[model samples]
Target chain A: MIRHIVLFTWTDDATDEQKATVTAELRKLPDAIPELRSYTVGPDAGINQGNHAYGVVADFDSADDYLVYRDHPLHQAVIAEHIKPILAARAAVQIEV
Target chain B: MIRHIVLFTWTDDATDEQKATVTAELRKLPDAIPELRSYTVGPDAGINQGNHAYGVVADFDSADDYLVYRDHPLHQAVIAEHIKPILAARAAVQIEV
Candidate 1:
């Protein structure tokens, strides 16, 4: 399996409503993309300082499956319309499991 | 459960051996720390451009359990001895799963 994890740090000016929209839109992805074997998205738990504001962890059977999710229209739209507007810094990694 | 994900970008001078050491050392943490419910660590799969070099995803039953793994001496040693020396950038998030 391949695990794709992304961390996002919102811009200082980003509003909470915008952040919530990102989460809501992300929560709809598993249903919209069949290749997703597992998915989890949420705000940071605030257990530590200096942590990114949000995270997404998605699993797929193979790299090819991950690519489908990566380029899916719904996924791209969420990134373009919701995430990009508030994004400050982003880091992502996809790893074999 | 609480899922803790951390992304890392290695310093330009970091060698393959150093990165390998970091992976090998991190693989030992689940056995060393009892609170970890699940853990995955690996270099990026290279399916995307401009992604972080590596990622770690760890799951714990609760926030307090995560704290135990977070502060574990063995885990800290791996960071101090292997990762910190070659660390370039890091982003982490702990979220409810």
Candidate 2:
């Protein structure tokens, strides 16, 4: 399995409404994309002050399968519409397991 | 369950031997710390240049349980003896699932 992890730090001015929208949109992804094996997304619980504000971890069968989900039109739409506008910093790492 | 995710970027001066040692040391934690329900750690596959150099995703039964692992003597030893010296940047996120 390919463990694809992404961390996001929201823009300083981003509103609660916008963050909620991003969460809802991301929750819709697994159902919309067949390439995903498993997916989890959530906000930081504030245990670590140095942590990112939000993160997602999704598993795919392989790197190629992950790429399919990454480039899917629905995923692109969400990035361009919901995520890009409010995003501050983004980081990711993919590991084979 | 609480999903605890941590991303790390090693210092520029860190050697390959140091990176390998960090990986080996971290892989020993699951058996050493009872609070860790599951753990996975690996190098960043370089798919994304903007991504950090490595990451770890660990699962725990609760926030308090995760803290137990975080502050465990064995974990602290690994961090202080291996990780902290080589780490350039670190970010983390913990969420309830």
Best by lDDT: 1
Model 2 agreement with the true structure over B1-97: per-residue lDDT tens digits: 9999988999999999999999899999998888889898999877666888998999999999999998999999999999999999887899888
Second chain TM-score for model 2: 0.96
lDDT of 1 by residue, A1-97 (tens): 9999999999999999999999999999999899999999999989899999999999999999999999999999999999999999999999999
**Which residue segments of model 2 deviate by more than 4 Å?**
none
Per-residue lDDT for B3-97 in model 1, tens only? Answer: 99999999999999999999999999988898988999999989999999999999999999998988899999999999999999999999998
Write down the lDDT of every candidate, Cα atoms only.
0.95, 0.91
lDDT of 1 at B90: 96
DockQ of each candidate relative to the true complex: 0.94, 0.76
Worst 10 residues of 1 chain A by lDDT: A26-35
Measured with C-alpha atoms, the lDDT of residue B46 in candidate 2 is 72
